[model samples]
Target: MLNAIDAIRIFSGDFQETKTFFVEAVGFEIGFEDEGVCVFDLAGTKLILEEVDLSEPEAAGMVGRFTGVSFATDDIKSTYKELSAKGVHFEGKPETEEWGGAMAHFKDPAGNVFTLVQYPPQN
Candidate 1:
């Protein structure tokens, strides 16, 4: 049987900088952290940041890639402003989609892309 996603792991070249971005800029509370890994509680799911050696083949090509992690917000405009003020830079202003929702894009210190989505309310 299938269940919810347990965790999403992100590889980082600079652990401290990347970790600071998620914890301080993104406002994610640290669930646990060690020498090379930091775990954050994203709502209920876990967001794991692992320090990786870019010189290694397995991790060399994975840094600075799209993470495919989208965070949901009730108010896109407010959320955008809040995060921007916290030193988070967005691609641009939020845009409305054909599905009647709003979305904004941003990248972390490691250049991994993430998104903020605001879905339309049910009638």
Candidate 2:
């Protein structure tokens, strides 16, 4: 069985801008970088941004796609405020979800969506 996700690949039309956004705005440390790819350490998992040709059939549909990368935080509200202050634009304030957790959405420079979530405390 698969134990864990080794990395997540996100496609971007503007590689430099997307890489900069993740490093500066999102506070992810750079793990590796090259001509068309940049890797970031996302708490342990690797977040890989790859440059792609949007005109190509296979990659055309992936541009601006929602990544579904959720980052868990102990305090959603404070995390939202801190990220917003760093020039990160969020969809809105954190809201309660049907799963009883608080979550907020945001996008990277290339419009790849991600979320910040805080689960309810277990008794």
Name the best candidate (by lDDT): 1
Model 1 agreement with the true structure over 1-123: per-residue lDDT tens digits: 868998999889999999999888989899999999999987779999999998899897888887788999999999999999999989999999999999999999888889899999999
lDDT of 2 by residue, 20-123 (tens): 88888878888899999998887669988999987799887786878898999999999999999988989999999898899999988888889999999898
- TM-score of each prediction: 0.95, 0.92
Misplaced by over 4 Å in model 2 are none
The stretch of ten residues in a row with the least summed lDDT in candidate 2 is 58-67
Report the Cα lDDT for residue 8, model 2: 91
Which residue pairs in candidate 1 collide? none
Find the candidate with the highest TM-score and give its number: 1
